[model samples]
Target: MSLPDIKEALNEYEFKWKAEQVTIQATLLKEHSDGRVTGDITITTQAKEYHPHIHQSQFNFSAGRTRETLAKTLHSRVPDLISLKQWEDIIEQLCVKIVAMIREGEPALELAIDDTKNIPPEYLLEPILLKGLPTIIYGEKGANKSTLSILFSICMLLPWKDNPLGLVCPTRSIKSLILDWEQDKEIVQYQAKCLKDGMNLPYFDVYYRHCARPLANDLPQIARNISKVGAEVIIIDSLGAACGGELNKPGPALDFFAALRELRIASIILAQTSKDTESKKKTVFGSTYFTYYARSVFELVKADEIDKTSSDIALFNREANYSARHDPIGFHLTYNGTGIMVQRQDVNIGQFIKRHSTQQAIYEVLKRGAMKPKEIAKETGENENAVRVALSRMKAAGKIVMTDQGYGLLSKDIMQ
Candidate 1:
């Protein structure tokens, strides 16, 4: 069988048909007496209509529902058609173009669902300060973990209630969706007003998705539910509340994490940690699943202060600590007239610089191909001084390598 002509994918008259909504397009590669084998496409609202340009055979599709629905349908049809694999290549290209176009045009308002960027670098002093990353703040029943969670939620909702807390940074506009299993919607709202004194600077969209029936125990079922939310970040608040059945069994909790990854949303789950344990090293008390799978973990401990009102927040590293620990990166929780705000304790600029520099250097080297330090510096438009420093550090970190030919990235795992 010959390769299907790309031109056959669209109709010539589609250009004049005002076919702006090509959200669903199917190219019937071969028509059987009863059914047809198709190269399916579903794009963004803008790309919903199919238009066949004479020069461009593959029309760029859009993102979101269109792309997802199309990919699933085509993938499902793969087993039915012998030629499905061949059409898949073309379909793959179309899928990519659609996703890119949608991202550029829509700018993550509705389409950007994945939470890969929320994870902090391993070395950072404050790995838990990520904007979109899901984090769980768990402690002993009376450890005030729930109080802290409530305060965090209020800070996002009414950012302006306190001094620097209300300061609108680039990340302040971030959208957060929380499934408060422990707290009721009314209580969460009351706390928000109390925290912010009715400042009314709406910044977050809070959802009251109380899990009456524990779905976390059923991994597949829970995964399907979360995937439909289209949220970049999610919070369970208290892990045990939603996770039903025996957590120590290792099947349900592990499966829950797996489902979280599939949902492509960053989450924060609260878990309890016992104080009687002599090990200061241990933070969260749960199955190893707490340490595994999580890109970063933090253990908040009470501070030894003259006044009980003051709290000491000790940060921890679980997996990656690209950010250093020496720097004071924390917040001093204080109550104001309306709400609470965490005042900045300190920030580690040096650590941030090193972490970002390494990440950027690795990315640059991978993108520009194998090259020596001098070549890399020149290509990246960085001074030789900066390049040498970065290269030396990268090499020591085992993120890159030197060969007879030139230097190159050590790992191809860098995501595009």
Candidate 2:
């Protein structure tokens, strides 16, 4: 055989032979300047069939030693050195050895009782995202999911005195990376300018990549980039575009998230709600695996009382595994000449609309004139019982009064 072939054969034999014994190994450490090979030929087996006192013997070859000479030297000293066959067989045997070793011992299941308390979750956005876990934000088209995600990224990147979302963050400023598959260069440039100007920060630490590759193919490269930049947070805009495979299938979904887990960076994945009304779930647009693997899930929807054209949005904490679900938060999206801007609005809007719907209906009807509960209910299209309950609450609040006819706004409070 040629010198290169002989060297390959010797290397293959070393690896395969080591696996059969408990502590036997042959390693080529280095080549000396004068053409001598220096390495260890160790034998740990206590078997009497092998030579005694050959525990960890070092072999230093003289200058100009050929591969055949090295192989002969190794074969003479090491007992039962296997010969290399086809490359496929070598690979197959290596795989088998690995599996056998892995299955050789059972793992311990007990935990140490003396260990300290478990670490509390570190929040990038408290109650919404934990530092080491994955978070997903889902909404229908035009629900501002991407805008909200961008806003969150900016908040994490900026050194704000107060929490931008009115939520808690463990750190004031975080290095963030946004892998946007949806937006173009112009849009992202505009967004960066907006965040920088709006926050009045001279500089921001967030990084952006307008990604075109699928998660499966690009995860390794993405991970290297993140590590190179030392990013603490990453956002994958619109999970569908990044997945590159049928998300409804379990294999691809699991694979995508598995890749994310391996990345070890806190992630925020944007997703869409199913266009088909009949197929829509409380979770995201695709397979349930998206929600199953996510640490937290949030949903964005159009505000009920707010007009769609008004650019109002409501954010709901659909799922939060680490903490209790938070109340719905509201936001107003508007372009501030740089990019789409997210302004936090009243968080109590959802609750207020639900709790005061009947009362507001009654108040509007009573503005015309005093009317009985049945008449008010008819005019407002609310249940009579609901109208009565609302009237009682409204009267107690001094916003309305019980008159001889029915109910009317308190004079002092009216026309104000």
TM-score of each: 0.45, 0.59
Clashing pairs in 2: none
Tens-digit lDDT track of model 2 for 59-156: 44332333344445434555363333222233334333433432343467987777798877888776667987999888877776766776777666
lDDT of each: 0.48, 0.65
- Model 1 over residues 1-416: C-alpha lDDT tens digits? 23222231111111111232222343212222343222223322233232322121223243345445444554454333324443344445554543443234224456565966775332111234344344555555554465555555444433333534322322343334566667787877766555555333455455446555453333333443455654445567677656666766676677556445544555666777744554534456656776665655655554534455554443334444334432223455655556654555542222222222444544545554678777776555557877778778877988778877677775563342
lDDT of 1 at 187: 75
Error of 2 at 261 (Å): 1.5
Most accurate candidate by lDDT:
2
Q: TM-score: which candidate is best? A: 2
